[model samples]
Target: MSLLSTQHTLQAYYLGLFGRAADPDGLNYWLSQLESGTLALDDALMLMANSDEFSERLQLPADDDWLAQVYPAYFGRPVDAEGGGYWSSLAAQGVSAPVLLQSIMASATGADREALDATTSIARFYSQQVSPERYDPAQTLIQEGLRSNEALYAELAAMDEQFDALTVMEVGESLEGRPLYSASVGSGPRKLMIVTQQHGDEPTGTEAAMLLLEWLSGDSPEAQWLRSEISLTVMPRVNPDGFERWVQLASGEASPDTTIDPRRNSADIDLNRTWDSSETLDLALIPEALAVRQEIARFQPDLILDYHNQNNYINAAGELETISILWPTNDLIDDQVTATAQQAAVALAQGVAEFDYGFLSLFPGGDTPQIARNGLAIDGVPTLLIEQRGLEEMELIAYEGLAVNYNALSSALILEGLMSMIGVITELGSGGLTDIDPALALQIPDRGERIQYQDIYTLSDERIDKEGMPTETELQPEVVGVSAAVLDDALAA
Candidate 1:
């Protein structure tokens, strides 16, 4: 066929696969072949079943009869002795028609300018439809209540109350000399330190920390109680340079001309992996990670939860064998932590389900430990890595829709988990004791349940009996009530 004819034919094939006949003559020719037993129905079906769009429309039972009638002539009859059918003989390997079309369009005879333009247009269109639009990572922190470092520090400084008299420390500077801020809240015996934005891309946790800080500074009863109970030190933006780089990449304005480049700030080092090695850290003195290390040394937290987005399955830290509370030494802590993580997973799954979203489980050998989860666990600070489903390109664009729901659900889970720890500490500390047996700490059920994407779907399905804990509403009545009261009090305070 001529080049133009080939292109037209391919386009018609794609349209047919999508259940649309682009050229009536071409479609009728294929249909006539099937009727005459020249073109086997199975072969025609194979040609038509190349795209997700095609699979979606093939309403199985509804189209089964039509498919049965048309599939046999295109291909020879099935060789099975037990009444083998054409439906069972359909080709398994199907090409993605849209991708194929784009490739074909790119290689077609055209000027360089035209080709590049077509390719860029196609890519951008696909990305816009399928990828997440980028935003300032700090926006998530702000939504979570931290605001910017400057804003948070200024807010803290303005409040002259004794509770707000804690020291504000500027540990290190970003590449742009934006000072990293850490505020020491309270003088409690057990110090808890949280550092956010280890990966510039994962901004959800950073935002959550900021929101928690804002809540603490406000006049809510829970905030007041939390402040009195624990000395919380939070470093909001550990990687400002990386975050700025991410923002610039997302906006497509990193250079004089607009384009996207995924790199660790200007130096291009993965900040999460920079720890424990001088060579890596020296090549790129990630001010964020360095500053966070200083803060960690200054105020050692009993527990830590460093957040990141795992594009694959959702998982917490630790192996399945070590995930229970029945083990010795760290078992009680493990149990409580695991229960908390599981409960959070359930809450997150449910929250996403309300919006018809789902996520996969962080199976043992997947992408969790090789990243940051293993690093934190090895460092002796019990940490759990929370993952949100979807890619950066997908989630970041739909961020606004997903953020509030995720943030609220995550905040509640973290708070509940932390409170479980706090309750243990409070009981131990009230008797004028410095420490309690880790074994003696009662295990909180539902701490670290691995709620996979499949589980979320199963629960959300109309037919299945939902497993795991009750909804977030049942788990956090007090927090929910206080959140409502906080809003009312914010207007009144």
Candidate 2:
């Protein structure tokens, strides 16, 4: 057979396995990947993997390092020594490249990690969005995805100690005993405590918080100002166990269909709700909550900011919302605190708008004092909760819907709010965060606060007609386009 004919046959066979015929474009992509190091053929494994570059296919199956092939395919970087050893061990025990790739994709890699290793994922989705000529190895990160706690801590520890204003310490541990860390910056007169991801599954806040850490650690004027004027304490991931649970959910070990949100720790108590609860007050039931509550007592922050993700039932405009800040319910909230938060919220929203970046709004309705934002508010510390967009929706809004990645924009807005709040305290001489405009906060729709938004379904990233059927357009075609029929319906799976 001709070389072209041989390629066509192989492409046809693979597509046939999926109950679909070959698209010439997909076949072309497949063939190009063969040259770009995508493992298109089982027989082409390079046994002597250490060479890094295989001048000629070895045609022998000796040291087939599935890890080597997949590391670059996924992370846009080679496997580290430890990773290479681990996966090479699996390959030595008889795993093939295809099997290893399947396992990697199935494990905790999730959509965000997969987005980085874009060539192997969602070619069809990007075909319309990103130009084929500009294909980079790792195409995306964030967009409703999360960084693993290990990955996050590694990055944090690796940051250079550039200033005395920054200090990293452990505040407490999760129910499963994962160390909870806090990064404290600044020694200013006022204190601002920011806690993120009290609910493990809510990871966008943690990502945004990391950006704040990076910014504050820098030599920028803003960083220097924040360092000298306000003491900032941030616990990026408060619910480590729940965050791990989110990783498990992505890996298919846990199901999102659970009755209670899997964001609960091992004891199955909602971490956010545990605050101020009778049981948690005495460190009775929720140890995780106690750890943070104790810290809050010691910190006595003038303002507390909690970050989170509200997911898709929100973001009604089919665009990435910059952030939604929630103030304490006015009922029991300190008038001064509310004024400060309201002033900060107004400035935060204005900053995002000024950049022409993401849209910012407020939590329109009354606050529920049970959640961490309101729960912490009860302590007389002003509080604001920031809800960033979820994954698929964030991807559409950040990657496809808008200009730059929403993360930088998100980080900036968060920093602005923190700065404004703390700045208010610093200028206490100018009369502290007095007030912005109650009318301004009222302008933001109570879209997410309403109970109806809670009890309903929201559309996924894929295109749907008025009848709600999948349209030709798909945000992640590889993830969703198979027929709805079960693969093995007889098993009731």
Candidate 3:
């Protein structure tokens, strides 16, 4: 069988499995066009092979044999077994060959490049500009990459040395008597408040802050833009005591037999809901709550961002939502304040959506005064909370132990989240965010609640329902709000 001699018609039956990997129904449309000779075989194959849906379905060596049989379909002729074998070996490596692996690697390096050259999507922007090499998610999760209180201070000291504009200050102490630190960076008029680690178990937000510090320490355009345009107030870890317990566990001081999450502070409280008001900041005997409020009071930011993480949510239908944002509001706030916060929320969600279109959502904020995002809004300072779906959920399957996988995923999730924050600030800085519809934010559906939500399963491996708190929405991606596309368009323009 020669590659070019025979003109074999494409089989419309397998079109559902191959080209239209995302939509089974797409086969019906393509099938008619395919069988009618309207849609060329090459075009149909190209559509399926380059898709993210195909990437997930790609089974490597397992698919290699199936592909040996499918090559007749791929090339419109029975491909030589020897030739197919040569190509199959190459596909195992990341080096993509356009003709052989177009369906799997999505047109190989050369073809993908050609496609990328003609058009730009938010996904392409991240792949081109913010490559994973620049912002490593896994490296920081390792032992050396771990950010302990000591590690954070050391990094901060080095950051201060690297950038004179960012000076680390000791604001207060944790309940366990660890130093609580804050930083006032740049001299720009806009004061942006960034708080992290209100929950001791949540450490990636602080890691993201460290990444921010490192970025600002550079002479890059982003660092320079931040220096000249905004003053960032960062309290990287408010709950040092809780983090310390986790750190000790990570270091092997405590047995892994106990539950991995060391969430509470020295006095044992979820500090996020501890700040009722300035006078009522104390929750239980946890001093971390007041310490965080003191830092917030010092900055008096016009816009506030509270960062945290939640478990990755997967509904009964098997859809995943990795990030969720909130424009937290109270009765004292007006539509304008809500809109402004929504603006920030939308921008961040938009920034993140490029990475995974269906992974983000903008939901109602906590109505309680005790919630930091809501409590901060009572004073009319528009606050946005970025809650990344928990990377901790991916520990075992994604990597090694709970510590390693959790830490690495947390760093990655936070970096992705931080990108959205950066995109929001960039949109605001460029004056590209004027009169954008606020209702567009709600168009991003809230992620649905998973029926079997849990932290790491119990020691016996039971998938426990970790929290009784139910999310207000269901989880699915294809609702048609181009939140990320809108922000990406603004950024690209």
Please tell me which predicted candidate would have the highest lDDT against the true structure. Answer: 3
What's the CA error at residue 344 for candidate 3, in Å?
Answer: 0.7
Cα RMSD (angstroms) for every candidate in the order listed = 20.5, 16.5, 12.7
**How well does model 3 score by local distance difference test?**
0.54
TM-score of each: 0.43, 0.55, 0.62
> Please, what are the lDDT tens digits per residue for candidate 3 over residues 151-192?
677667877877767788888787668888888776677667
Residue 110 Cα positional deviation in candidate 2, in Å, after optimal superposition: 19
User: Which parts of model 3 have CA positions greater than 4 angstroms off?
Assistant: 1-127, 130-145, 250-252, 255-261, 278-284, 315-317, 391-408, 432-434, 451-493
Residue 332 displacement (Å), model 2: 2.5
Alpha-carbon local distance difference test for all models: 0.39, 0.50, 0.54
Quote model 2's TM-score: 0.55
Clashes of 2: 1
- Cα error of candidate 2 at position 123, Å: 22
Answer with 2 or 3, whichever has the higher TM-score: 3
Q: List the residue pairs that clash in candidate 3.
A: 49-103, 310-390, 448-473, 448-474, 448-475
Cα lDDT for residue 203, candidate 1: 56
Which one wins on TM-score?
A: 3
